[model samples]
Target chain A: MSVVIEAHNISKRFFLGERNQRAFFEDVSVKTIRGLRRLARRRLAPEQSSSRDFWALKDISFQISQGQTLAIIGENGAGKSTLLKILSRITQPTTGTVKVYGRLASLLEVGTGFHPEFSGRDNIFLNGAMLGLSRKDVRKRFDRIVEFSGLAKFIDVPVKNYSSGMYVRLAFSVAAHLNPEIVILDEVLAVGDTVFQKKCFDRMEEIIDEGHAAILVSHGMAHIRRMCQICLWLKNGRIKMLGPTDEVASCYEKATTHEVVAHYEKQTAEQHGPTHPSAIAGLVQWSVQSKAASAPHSIIVSQAKVTFRFEIELTAMISHGKISVSVADAQGLILFTQQGELGQITRGKFWATLELPFLPLKPGEYIVTCTISEADHPVAFLRATPELTVLKDESLAQSGYHGVLNMPARLSVEQIPQA
Target chain B: MAQTSSAKETRVQSVPEIVTGTNDALPSAKPTYVVDADKILSSHPKDLWAYRELYLLLVKRDFVAVYKQTVLGPLWFFVQPFLASLVFIVVFSQIARLPTTDLPPLVYYMSGIIVWTYFSNSLSQVASTFLSSGTIFRKIYFPRLIVPFSQISMNFLNFIGQLLVLFGVIACYKLSGHRIELSLKILALPLVLADMALLALGLGCIIAAATVKYRDLNIVVGYTLNLWMYGSLVIYPRSAVPAHLQPLLALNPMASFVESFRSCLFDTEHTTVQPAVIATLMTIVIAIIGIWCFAKAEGTFTDSI
Candidate 1:
């Protein structure tokens, strides 16, 4: 296949002090005085730290062939948008040249280059032209664009009045009908409701099938896994890994999962200030921990105890108290509960531990809830939720493993039963 | 192109056509693009020509959208020039009693204000191109000239409206026993209008480009235009200007632009050949410089804006 897009040695360096806004007088005069100061400072130090240089992208190079799609996966600050802006020609690369071989249309953002004041009909022509299509081309596909957006009724209405979903649909519809040889999409698929997202996916698949080269910046592994042939993993603006989509996706997943270990203090809003005068004790902090409270990211396996530690601040004194706990999935479905038991309590700080054992849950995320009470009367009730995750055990067969259950099971099929 | 070259940062110090120069093995069926470390000039006039329909649509957008919301609609267009002319008649003729070239004060000021409004409108619109279009510029890339060009085009549409009103006023003045003769120099009205547009576009693009970094130039532009109007002898005829300063003020391209434009309507002295010729030449030079500045500004502007 012929290469449709090629980028060589693309590096963009931005000045730290450079600001983008300029109204007439407000910025100009200040900028002028500052410019002179900068000149003097440059003469004195030659490499003033005030005029710092930031390399958004450094020595990046890639090429995409016809009908091939590359997924660009990275964290938020990994220069994904910068690379797209350079490739889309919205901004010039500081020290590189990007030569697109054919007509290029970039959906860098939804409703980008759209005029909200313009009616949908007018915006179609304007947006199409901005995307390098001529008026005749936009006219030819006008009905199709309206139909694809399912916004025929609102085509004459100004886009400002559109719900965000409607605006995204129309914008995507225009981009979907683009016949350019190369299209660049930047996280636009993560928009609209599920049906529209599905349409976006289907339209993208259709575009790929039509042999147009594409470069997509997205975080959705399912979409990337389905549509992308290759992937480029960016870490701090450098290519960390680049190869087959499945392999790179797995690498990214592994890296992210292992790196997500965090220490979190469950400080509720009311717990931060003074407790009620009548209250004897209040919850200070609660945490869900793994091993020895060093890290919290590890997944709990089947039938293993996961630690839930709670800290309480006693205002005056309490004769006896009991703590109740409940665990719920993300959808608020209570999966486990521990009834309160009376215990002797005193003034000042208090700490307690609850280990949830035999959590017969599948590999999914769950949250914990806790409350404190005395004599069946609530003194300080904490409805705060802390989250925990459970990973599937490798020993279990990956069949009938949907929903929130991982019960032990034995299966056998004997031919003698039929005889 | 089907070439097996290693992917490396070329750091193209200049242009990178040499990459293709060495790639003799590349398949001719495919096209290739090499991104270079250097900035490339991208103001292809042909690209603007190709998007002509978009240009007209945008002009329509500027014209129709402005009046789209107003209850009076396009009558606002006539209201501005008319009121300005009426003010000039009251101020310049009644109070100051400025010398005139044997034409009715209303007709004389109408011609001058008509020409001046077109010139000022084009200049200010083009001047604000960077500020007004910065949002569109950040989100999309097109021929950057289109923003300034569309401003001039929109002003031209308003000029047509003003021109019709000028004809109506002249016709009315002729019925009121005022002698107004059509000078053949009126045939050069198109040339005069071109001069106005070119001068505005040239100067406006420079200001637009300059205002990107040194925005104080915007204030300077505001003051300079007011001064420039006085320098152009728009209210009074050229004969009212002292002979000593006549030659110096004639250096202002707009001086001759306004004079020649008014000379087309006023049956006044047709001695505008020299100044008009000088202004036309200066307009071309200014336009060349303007385009150069604008081209240089467009690439780096995204960084600042």
Candidate 2:
């Protein structure tokens, strides 16, 4: 396939410093004072005069062949939009070059270049012109644009008078008529009604079928997976991976969960048994451990046997004791709950452990709750928290099932004789 | 061989690469456009030419949109300059005792009002080019000069409307058998008009480029333009100035254009060729610099904006 676009070693640096902080007029007004300050500071330490730089994109490179669509996926500040801007030629990279062998049209924003006071028809011609189409070209596709927008009636009315819905429809219809060989789309597809979005997808598919190339920046994963053939996963302004969509997508998903785990870990505080000795003397030690003590509970594989252990202290004698263990998911939805009666405990300290043969949980972090109270009276109690995470890597799950239960389904193949 | 690295493109053969037809090996002669930091400072004239239709369409937008919500619509175009001329007659001719040349105060002030209003209004539009269309600028890439250039097209329509009123006033004089005559200098009308436009465009481009980064210039420019109105010979004839300040007054490029416009109307012969020539040369230089600064700021404006 012939390459339609080639980008090489692109980097964009934004100056962000005391001098850069002030824009044009502010810079002029404050120059004398800043100059004076600079002179004094330079006499002491001259190296501090340098302006700090924030590289929005760093040494990025990619090639887009005809009929290929590339998806750019990243966390919010990962330079996805910056790269889009560079590709669209709205901004210049600090260094490097980009070559495109086809006519290019970009939709970085929904109806961004529309004149509000213009009539729908006039805006179509104007926006078309803005996209580099001649007046004749606009006239040719004018009817199609009107028909697609369903704004045929409002074509002569000023767009300011049209409802915003009608405005977006007309803008998008004009944009859809572009027959350029290379298309750059930002998240502008998120606008308008669902029908418009579907139409946008269909139009994109039609363009790709004609062997035109597209570079897209969208956070919608399902759309990315469906529409894009290749993916660029940007992390902190650098390409973390550039490969087939599925490969990069899976890696991105894993990284997202890892971030979630890191965020969840900060909220958890594991305290040793007795911080408040006088406050609650009901329990001396409470912890959750693996039943076999072979695999650490810190990394619990799904369907693994594990135990919840607790030690309770009776400063005063108590009768008809009870114990309960509740396993809650990350969002605090209780997935499993178990309770049993404990006969009278009149001792200083006592240990109780509850073991499950199979965890029967999905692969995720869970909060474990243990409660001890008198059987008849629900008031006397001690509760301890131990967070649990069930690991269910495909290679780790012996039964090879992903969800809550791993049931083994027998598989046998029998060859049928040719009829 | 046809991969012409610049965008001065020939017609592209719009065939799909995947087509298994016999023409597959035909060198798909399409021009290539390479963008880098170095290209930021240079204005791509070919790209601008290709999108020239958008400029006309934008001009149409400006014209149609100006009177959009108003009930009077395009009629206000005639009313606006006439009213302003009346105000000039009342304020300057009557109260300030400014000279009205040999023509009636109404006609003289009307001539000045039409020319000055077009210049000032177009200049104001140029000044606000970035702030008004900043949303469009951030969203897409087009030649930034197109925004300011569209302002000229919009003002030109308004100028034509005012010119019609000027002719109507002049016809009344002719019908009265005053024997009005045209001078050879009147033939220079198109050149003078172009000078005004270039002056506004060049200055507007400079200010538009500056105010985007130093937005505080927006308020200052409005205030300055208002003060600048008095500096020009719009309300008074050039002779009204003292002999010592005559040279100082001539330094303003609009001085000759405004004087020449009046001279062309009444054959006052006060139109000096020297100032007109100076204004033309200054306009050319300003146009070059203005375009340079505006184009330089265009590429990275999104980051600052």
Candidate 3:
């Protein structure tokens, strides 16, 4: 298939600055002062300074084939709108190049190119022609456009009087009806209510079915997954990942999760150092003991024995210390916490064992954090080590226990005869 | 067409297959960076030609909508200037005793008002083009120049309508035993109107560009036009200025334009040829600057607006 749109290393830079009042005044004064001084200075001066440049899009490159839909998914400020503007030719790129093979119609913003003083009918033709449709084409599709907009009665009225929803509906109808070879939409589906948004998505599907290319920039991952076969995840103005929708989305989710974990680690690192006078400093190690040496890294609830060993370094160890062990779910809801009494505490190395008659947690992941404190002052703390995982038991299938937690209950039912 | 279709199909298949298989297998086409300035410039004229029908639709809209709900309808085009000329003739000529440059006071003031009306109307409307057309400009991709161009054309139609009324007054004055000499140099009236339109458009483009970002230009434009009218000798003759202020007065381009227009229409002898040349040069210079500013602003005005 032929590539309908190709953007190569496209970067857009915008410079923002206050007007140079001093330079302007000095230049004006120099022009007035006259003679050979201005001539000599002009010959000697280097180029003038521009203010500061902000990179809205930094080296973004992608290509779209004809009849293919490429979905761009990113958080706000990810340069989606900037890329669309460059593609639409509404703005020029500061660097790099974008080549579009055929006619491009961009619905970057709804109700663009609408003259409010003109009647809706006039604006339809005006906006249609602006989108690259000829007058005859607009005339040919005139009735269908108005019908789609559901504004047949209001077509002759000025658009300034249109309700916001009616205005967007009419504007979108004109854009879709114009039928340019490449369509670029930027979050315009968020306009109108749910029913109208569905109508728009249906229309977009129809347009795609007709074998024209489209680039959809949307925040809704579900929408992208549904409508687009290919997805590009943008991070900080560059393509983070681009490929199949599911793969790219999963990668994006993983990267976001890692970011959150990194942030949490940074926040917790400053509070605590070490609890006891062990050789290793600030290290709490927990491992599950199994006959199989290559058992999966995470601890399961059905494990034979779980050992939590705390190794801490003491700056100056004098007296009593207690170690608290807490198990929490993913949402940081503590299911349980156990405090080893002072008699159980040794100088450096601390070992604790908790035995369960039956594993309490069903099937899910959980975290275990250890806090070591002396008289309520936290001396050392460590978050989850070998993050816990619980697997579903096939053996328990007959018992009717089907979830993450197993609660034993007995019930007796008595049937009453109904007439 | 068949080749395009099959090629498009093949391209579509290739993209997903290559992407799904391996990223390294994709075609190695880097972006092109030739920067075709001619292509950009030609896009404007091409769009104008392609969108000609829309331009006519806009012109039709300008004509009908201006007089649509008014009581007098299109007749007000003639009624407005006729009444205004009569008032100017009475107030500025008879009451204020302003000097008329070798022509009847009514004919002289009416000629100036006729040309002044076209320039002022075009100037006022052109200044508002950015704000007025902001809605349309933001949504679609057309040459931004079209709005102001269409505005000037619409005002041109109104000026021609009012010109007929001026001709009737001139004919009536001729029949009333006053010798109204007809000069062949009156053929130059179109040139004067063209110059006025260009000058107005250039100034309007500058004002429109400024108004998009500053917003204060809108207010400044309204008041500036009023002050501008007094300086242009619209109500009185250019010769009425004191000799010392003549050079400064001559610097106002509209003064020379109006004076030159009156000379052509009324066979007046006191024509400021030097000032007219300066005014024409100024107009051209302003137009070039305006176009350059507009081209630079076009890229980012969407964001600012």
Interface RMSD of each: 9.4, 11.4, 10.9
Across B63-116, the per-residue lDDT of candidate 1 in tens digits comes to 878887799988988888789888988899999999768888877787777788
Taking all chains together, each candidate's TM-score versus the true structure is 0.75, 0.74, 0.68
Better of 1 and 2 by lDDT: 1
Task: Please give, for residues A193-281, the per-residue lDDT of candidate 3 as tens digits.
Answer: 78878778778777766646888888655566666778887755766667887667545543443344444555555454442322223
**Per-model C-alpha lDDT, please?**
0.73, 0.72, 0.69
- lDDT by residue (A35-151, candidate 2, tens digit) is 887878755333222245677788988787778888889877778888887877778888888877888888877677777777777788888888778889989999998998888
TM-scores of the first chain across all predictions?
0.60, 0.61, 0.59
The lDDT ranking, best first, is 1, 2, 3
Ten residues in sequence with the least summed lDDT for candidate 3 chain B? B5-14
RMSD after Cα superposition, model 2: 10.6
lDDT of 3 by residue, B1-305 (tens): 21222222211112223243223333445422222212242145666777776676677777777886689888987777768778988888788989886678777777777788899889888888768877666555677787778888999998888887788888998899787886777898898899999999888888877766667778888778878888898887766788998888867999989888887777777656788889999999998877666666666666656
Task: Give me the runs in candidate 3 sitting further than 4 Å from their true place.
Answer: A16-52, A116-118, A157-162, A190-193, A255-419, B1-42, B62-87, B171-186, B207-220, B238-250, B269-282, B303-305
Indicate the residue-level lDDT of A234 in model 2.
81
